[model samples]
Target: MSEFLRSRRARLRPRDVGLPEYGGRRRVPGLRREELAQLAGVSVAYYIRLEQGRGRNVSSAVLDAIATALRLTSAERDHLMHLARPVSRRLRPVARPQRVRPALQQLIDTMENVPAYVIGRRLDIIGWNRLARALLGDFAALPPEHRNLAWQVFLDPSARALYEDWDAKAADVVGYLRRDAGRNPHDPDMASLIGELSLGSPEFRRLWAAHDVQDKGFGGKVLHHPLAGRLVLAYETLTLPADPDQQVITYHAEPGSPSAAALRLLASGQEKTTERTLSCSEA
Candidate 1:
């Protein structure tokens, strides 16, 4: 909570909230404790306590006032509340395998023309359809640890080659992991994953320290696939109602686009290969 609050406070500037800039340069990024105290109608010492992890029994009014002073969005404010009022949650290993629902599997199977997959809390790829396997690499062939999205994005050669903008997407994946870490501070699995990633990739550490948070939504992506060459696609990520921790991300190329033509060719190749394998097994 302290770290998150400090990060949030550090992002705001004095001039942002109508504070007159003094001629002398100020040390803090945002309002200092004293300035925030004045804005939030609280004692400077009391606000210091909260920021420094010394405050207990913090009142809702103070929180509301601080939120107003910070101009936090609804989601950020809710995240702040969760950080302040966290409950003990069950711990799960970051590499723990997740099961996909039969219905979801069936749904993805039916959408043979589209690439689709399921991802779990740790951003681990839990399940994928055949088209997804072609587009995103064969997740089933990877070790469980290597199946995680962030891990693959950072560590796998194929992943780096597949993305047109590897660095941006890699940062986004790290940001998601950072947000999850904030929410589950006590989880040993998360701690272990962070430690490993920090040791392995300096880029991951740099991104993790940035403390960015992004909610899942629709987006467009371009990938340079070995089989399909340059392909552009739009994707929508939908969180499962039954299991909020799980999400289904589906990708589609616009009709009559070059990407769509590439996808069709890829699908045809995969189908022919499948038929050949089946015939060999029967023979």
Candidate 2:
């Protein structure tokens, strides 16, 4: 939380927030603590305590004031709230694996031309359809421990080659992880994942430290698939209301576009491969 606050503070300039610039050389790059306190209408000492991660019983109003002073987006403000008041003190490692409801799974499976997958807590890929496996690598082939978006994005060489803008995709994954970390501060699984990624990828380490928070609810991605070739897909992330921790992300190509045609071809090939495997098993 302290690091998050400091990073957000470091990103702002005095002039950017309408603060008069002083002539003498300033020691810090962004708004000083006192300046931020003044903007938030809080005492310097109190804001100091909050920034230092020592303030307890912090009120929402004060957080809102600080968020406004920092010009945080809605997603960022929500992250700040989570940091201030974590969801769990020490979340026990979930014993059972996350499962997608049968109905939900069926719905996605029927979308032959769309690539869709479900991600649970820690951004782990829990369920995916045939097209999703074809577009994005085979999630079933990966070990359960490594069936994670962040894990694949950072550690998998194929992901680097798959994403047209690897850096942007990596940053989004880190930001989402950071937000989840704030909500579940003592999640052992999350901590383990972070530690592993930090050791494995320097880029992940750098982006994790940046403290950028966002909810990527909708976005577009350009992927270079080995079989489908270059594809531009727009994705929508929908949170499951029944299971808020789980989200379904579905990717679609523009209608009548080359990417859409590629999706059809991939779906057809996927269907044929599945049928062949089923026949072989039966025989």
Candidate 3:
């Protein structure tokens, strides 16, 4: 984890990150120890000790300040918190997939107004409703190995075109997955996913080395649609209490907003299209 921290810190630039460049030739890529310490409100010695792995037990408050100074996303902040502490000795093995309980499936089906889907800790899309399918499209239709959020974001060309703010979105995906990797470092699936993406996508490779992590949570997203042009939506992620590693993400648009109107229009058309396809199959 110290290696991860050092690697991420080295990738950031002083001027680009709002730190003043000291007038001198430097051997490092990002802000100097003193600069980072100043930005994070810590002493240069303390920051150096932490980076060098001499200071292992860091407080959450200090970590939060450091994460803020780094301009880390929510997911990245969470990962930093996890890494500041030593790994747990009693960590459990990864759980196997099972049918999403009938009740949960029903709950998803009942969310008529919002688009929602359940994803496992490994970022696998385990279950989702028709609206989710319509919004995200056939990416979920791919094989399980290819259905991961990170894979879709980096490997799929369509994802780059779909997101209005593609770079930000890509960072979020990488950060979230990094957090997941830190939490379950022993999980072979997590390792394999990371390896595949690292090998396949240059963008993924670059971001992965940054060691940024984030807490999965609610946020705003801007999407460029093939049919609707552009839409902005608020997203919320809720962890299932019963299912330890499963989370439901829902998308909503403000009432009377063009995005909301467009969602309604899309929903109606999607329902009609489903009916027509079913009818054609029956005939």
Per-residue lDDT of candidate 3, residues 133-201 (tens digit)? 888877456987777788888888899888989999888888778777777767778888888898999
**Most lDDT-accurate candidate:** 2
Q: List, residue by residue over 1-283, the lDDT tens digit for candidate 2.
A: 8988999999998899999977577787788899999999999999999999999989999999999999999889999998898755445555456899999999999999899999998999999999999999999998999999999999999999999999999999998998888777877899999999999999999999899987979999999999889999999999998888899999999999999999999999999999999999999
Full candidate order by lDDT, most accurate first: 2, 1, 3
The model with the greater TM-score, 2 or 3, is 2
Residue clash pairs of candidate 1: none
Which pairs of residues have clashing backbones in candidate 3? 74-215, 75-213, 75-214, 75-215, 76-213, 76-214
On TM-score, the candidate that comes out on top is: 2
Task: For residues 1-283, write the lDDT of model 1, one tens digit per residue.
Answer: 6777777788887789888766578766776777778888999989998988888777788888888888876656766666676655544345434799898899998888899999886677898998999889988888887778888887777777899998878877876776566566676767877888888888888887766665646888899998799999999998899887789999999999999999989888878888999999999
Q: Rate the local accuracy (lDDT) of all candidates.
A: 0.81, 0.92, 0.80
- Where is model 3 poorest over a 10-residue stretch in terms of lDDT? 91-100
Cα error of candidate 1 at position 217, Å: 1.4
TM-score for each candidate, following the candidate numbering: 0.90, 0.96, 0.77
Candidate 1 lDDT for residue 37: 84
